[model samples]
Target: MAGEYGLKRYFDADAARLLGGRIRAVQPGFDVEGYAAEVDSRIPGKELKDRVLVLAEGLRTRLPADYADAVPVLLAILGDELAEGEGMFTNSWFLMPVARFVEEYGLDHPDLSLDAIEEITKRHTGEYAIRPYVEQHYAPTMERVAHWARSPSHHVRRLASEGIRSHLPWARTLTMFVEDPRPVLEILEPLRSDGSEYVRRSVANNLNDISKDAPGLALATALRWMEESPTPETGRIVTHGLRTLVKKGDQQALALLGATGGEHVRVPRLSLTPGSVAVGDTLLIGFDIENTDGRAHRVAVDYVVHHVRKNGRSTPKVFKLATLELGPGERRSLEKSHAIREVRTRRYYAGEHTVDIQVNGLVRATGRFDLRT
Candidate 1:
C-alpha cells in the first residue's frame, strides 16, 4: 500500500485550480487557466518533490519575472499562520511549492527572501528554502537566523536550528557547518532551554547530525549543556544528540548517561522463539540480565541484529531495549518481538542472523535465527 500511496496525488489538477484561483484573487489579470495547464501538463509520473518543483516553475513563468516583484504576490497567498502543534502537511501543504519557488529564484534577493522565509515559516516551513541563503550569503543570513533563534514564534526558532543542520534530510548537506560546527553550536546555545519541545527537538537533531562527523565536539557540547543548563529540555537534547555515539558503545557517552559498569553485568540466557522464520513472520527474543557488581548500577540495555547482506556478509543494526536501575545482584527478564516485514529503507535476505544482548556498551549474550525467503 505504501507503493500505492503517492504524494504527488495531493498536487493533482484540483490543487492546481485552487492555487491558480488564489493567485488570481490577489493579482488581477493573472492567467489562472494558463498556470493550471502548466502545472497539470508536467505533473503526471513526477514524484512528490518534482511535482512541487513543477508548480514552482509554473509560478516563475506566470508571475512577475523580477524576484522582488514576485515575492509580494507569493506572500499575499499565504492565508494565516499555522496554529501551535499544526504540521505543514495539513493546512499549509500548498506552501511547499511556494517555498520551493523562493529557494529556486530568490538567492540574489536575500533581504526580500529572508523576510518571505520568516513569514512563510509561520504558516509552513522555511527550513529547506533558508538553506540557499545560508549557503550563499553566510554571515548576514546567519545573523538574521540568530535573530530568528530568539523570535517569539516557535516555528521561526525551529527554522533557526533546522535550516543549518549539517545533514538535513531531503536537503543538500551544509558542508560548511559539517566542516566546522562551532557557528551552528553558537546559534543552538540560546535554544537549549527553549520552552517549545518542537524547537528543542530540532536542536537535538542538529546536534545528532554534528555527532556523525564531529563526535568529540558533540560529546563535549552535550556535557557542557548538561552542566550549564540541567533542565529536562536540555537533558532530552543531550540524550538524543549523543544517540549514535552511545549506540557505538562509546564509554564516555555511556558514562555520561550513567550507563556505566556494563562489563560487570551478566546475561544468563538469550533465547529466540521460532529460531527459523519466513520474511513476514515474527521473531520473539527473550533475555535475562543480572547485575553482578557490588553496588547498584544503571543499565542501558540494547540488542543488535546482524542482518544478512546480498554478499552474505552481516551488517549490524542496533535497537533500544530498556533503561533501568538495578540494585546489586538484581535480576530482570525482558521480552521483545520483532516483526520482519517489507519496508522502503531496507531489503530482507535469507540467511542466519545473529542477535546480541548489549548491556550499557558491553555485549553480554548472543543468539541466532535463520531467515527463510
Candidate 2:
C-alpha cells in the first residue's frame, strides 16, 4: 500500500519541484533547490503525514527568517480561492507545511498565525494547522474562530468548526474542547443552518466527535437544534452527528431521534434464508415486525451478524435495515441481502454465525447461519 500514489509519490521530488517553482514565483530570491532537496532527503519511506512536517522543516530552513514575510510569499503562491474539480487539495498540500511551521513558531506573535491561517484556509484548509494555535491561545484564538463562523466564505466557516474538533482525524485533538466543548459548540450553533453542505458536514462531524466522549451534551445539542429550527441542512447535520451513537444502538440517541419508543413492538418472524452460507456468497435475512401498542411507534430495525474471525472467534457487526413509523396493531415485512466477501478490513473463517433483529435498541429475535470457505 505504501507503494501506491497516496503515499509513495505524494511528497516525492516532483512535488518538491512544483512547490519550489510556486514559492520561487512569489519570492524570486527564494532558494528552491535547497527546499526541494530537504523535502526529498527526508521524505522517502516516510508516510505522507511525516512528509508534511518534513516539508515544513525544509521551508523553515530555506525560507526567510521573518515568519510574517515568509507567510505572505506562501500566500501569494496560493490561488485566491480553492480549486474546483480534480486537483482540489492538491495545490494546498504546500499549505500543510506552511501551517505546521506556524503551529510551532507562531506562538509569540499569535496574530500573525491567525492572519496566515485565515488567509491560507481560503485556498485550502487550516483545520489541522490551527489546532495547536487554538490549544496555545484559547481565549483570543477562539474569539477569532467564533467570528469566522459568520464569514461569507463557507470554507472559512468550515474552518471555524473543523479546527476546533476534539478528535479531528490526521490532526491533534483540542484537549480543552474535549474536556469542555461549550466554546466550540458556541461557534457551531450559528452555523447549524449554514447553506453550504460543506460547512454543514464539518459542523456535524464536529458534533459527532464530541458525541464519542460527551454523548449527553451532544444529544442535548442535537435535540435543541432539531426542536428549535431544523432546516433540511440542519436536519442532515443532526442525523449524521448522531450516526455513531445510533450504530451502537444507544437507546437515548434512538429515542431522541424518534427512532425508538417501541416497547410494544415484537418480531414474530425472523429467519435467515437457507440457514447456511459460504464465504464470498450472499445471504438474505427476512423479518416480520408487529406493533402491539395502542399508539404509533417509531421503530429503527437493525440486524447484527456475529462474524467468525480466523482466530476462531466472532465479532458482532450491526447493519441498519429501516426506520419507519408503525401504526397501532400494524405489521410490516422487511428483507435485506448481505454479502459475505473477502474484504481488506476483515478475514472470514468458517463457523456457525448468529444473527439478531433489533427494534429500537433491543434485540427481539435471534437466528443462525453456517459459513464455510
Pairs in clash, predicted candidate 2: none
Quickly count the clashes in candidate 2.
Answer: 0
Scored by CA lDDT, what does every candidate get? 0.89, 0.81
How many steric clashes between backbone atoms does each model show? 0, 0
Candidate 1 lDDT, tens digit per residue, 1-373? 0231444578866777788889999989888788888777898888777888998888899888888898999899999898778878777877888899999999988999999999999999999999989989999999999999999999999999999998987788999988999999999999988999999999999999999999999999999999998878788898898888888888888898778778889999889989999989999999899999888999899999999999999999999888989999899999999999877567889999999999887889999999999
For model 2 the local lDDT of residue 327 reads: 92
TM-score against native, each model: 0.94, 0.83
